[model samples]
Target: MRITGYRALNTVQEWGRAVGDANGVYADGLTEVPMVLVTTDEGITGVGMGPHVELDAVFAAIDGEDPRGVTALYDRMLRQMFKAGHAGTVFGTIGAFDTALWDIKAKAAGEPLWRLLGGRDRVVPAYASGLDIDLDDEDLIRTYQQYAEHGLRTAKLKGGLDVERDRHRLSLVRDVLTEAGGGARPGLMLDANECWSRKQAVRHVAELERTLDLIWVEEPVRRWDAEGLAAVGRGVRAAVASGENLSGLEQFRPLLAAGALDIVQTASVWGITHFLRVAALAHGHDLPVSPIGTNPVGLLHAAASVPNHLASELQVLQPPVGVALDLRIEDGAFVLGDSPGLGVVLDEELIGACELQPATSSFDGPGVRPERAGHRLLAAAG
Candidate 1:
């Protein structure tokens, strides 16, 4: 089978709570458009989510393609295009298409992607991610309490602003867990979102080292600061975790080799196939992997396919509008579905009915911006 056509859908929704990460303050919520890539052969179609691509250009690039040569086709697009910007939203868009191609291949073969990945017992553990940073002490505790009741084993808190405020919040969460019992004290992790400099990261995180009992402190310094990240990893009481911004196995070699990062996180932008490749490279060095989310579909597939991954990141609060694609999340772990490839499907009627729209231009804002191409490639391979 070959890809006969492709399409893009960009949707925006008002986030219930403003989310702050190493990226910046998402004050008015976020406008995230989930691009869909459609591949058809004999009219049977497979769909994947490509984020921001000049979708028109993407269609022209891969309109007529071999369904089997998914990897080669992906490389062809990368090699041919002068990918602008650091992470290449366009290439990331390509990732969506590559995913669609894989779905088609798996469906044709009558097996799931996990089976292809050296099949293990399905269903991997999940942790609640995309938690709001601005919640008050009371609300934060309530949130953790709720997750604990739901059978979640772990939770990640967003950190990186006021040291005192963060400390207070962590203390509250710890206290709630202690008080609530019923394994309310799930494993805790922290993500700084690269909001601090090397020096600041060291000082601020040191304060929580003894108190929080963090499973890992993610992106405390910055994405490309090898020396700085190494310093934070060495100095902190918690294990230092990073690499969600990273792509390609070669680029991740150095961070793994240097032992600068404790957990090597990969995102869906690399697609599930490459995700495992990077995971294996990290595993070779005895490093664990934690893949990021693009909603239930990608998260479930990655959790199923990659055995070495620590936990799949789930956005409990997805944007308020647009399509509702739900995967079961009980007790902090994602429940996988038996329905064919990726198992989850987008409601097109819901997509059309929803008012969420994509941003007209790229969001240029404060905090650490996306990296440059050369720098990212170097960081990945360093």
Candidate 2:
């Protein structure tokens, strides 16, 4: 099929808070960007995230490219944006197109996205993410307990803010685990969201050594700090987990070569097409892939087929208000159905209702309000 139309819908959604991490508080319960690409003639449409500016740019890049040549079109669009830097802000744009292209391919094949990659597995393991870091320790523990009750065996907690307070919180989680009464304690992991310094990460890892049995400690330092990540990897007893912020496969080269991380979390940075390349490299190194994103999509499908995949990250929130698609979670895993094309159909009405208007802030980073017309990361600008 040929090209058709590209639309970027910027709408508000209740983004949950991530507490006790580099970002002091994390919540953008407002207009979030969603971009959708529609191909007519064949009447196939794909939906993904746009993060505002990047979505518009993606539309401009491949507005008329042949939908069948998704791989070629993806490369052409991505290569054109190279000089603009390859991480952070660029991913929002890249990820949008990636998901859309996958949608097109699946529609063409007349198969579910999961089966295109590999047949659906019984269930995909998940970790609880999007925990509001601002919650009190009691609240956090209670929340985790509730997840444990729901058959979730692995979960991620936020960290990298205050060393002392983080330690206390970790201890509380462990206490709850003991009280919950299981054969082995539920798997506990941490994501600092690029908040800590190398020194702080080292100290935190030393404290958690063999205590809580963390699957990994994610993004202990800033995203680009290869040396710091490597140092933490070498110094820590727990595995070093990262790679949610990198754009393409090339950016992960240094981290892998330097042996900076134990688990590599690759997302649909420009969608599953590039994510496969990153997963292949991580597999070659015998490292596990932990792709972060909620629900059943092509990205989740990629993780399910890859042998090296450890688990998938699921947001600890109900589906967006008015969303109709339901990807069920049972015993800490997702159940994918036999539906065609990513197994998700956007609730057009819901999408329209939440259409983004104007927001005081942008997705630049935590707490960084939009200034002028451009987005700014809180950590970098401050």
Best by lDDT: 2
| TM-score of model number 1 | 0.86
Q: Model 1, poorest ten-residue lDDT window?
A: 373-382
Question: Lowest-lDDT window of 10 residues in candidate 2?
Answer: 373-382
Alpha-carbon error at 191 in model 2, in Å? 1.8
RMSD of each: 5.4, 4.7
lDDT of each candidate versus the true structure? 0.65, 0.67
> TM-score for model 2?
0.86
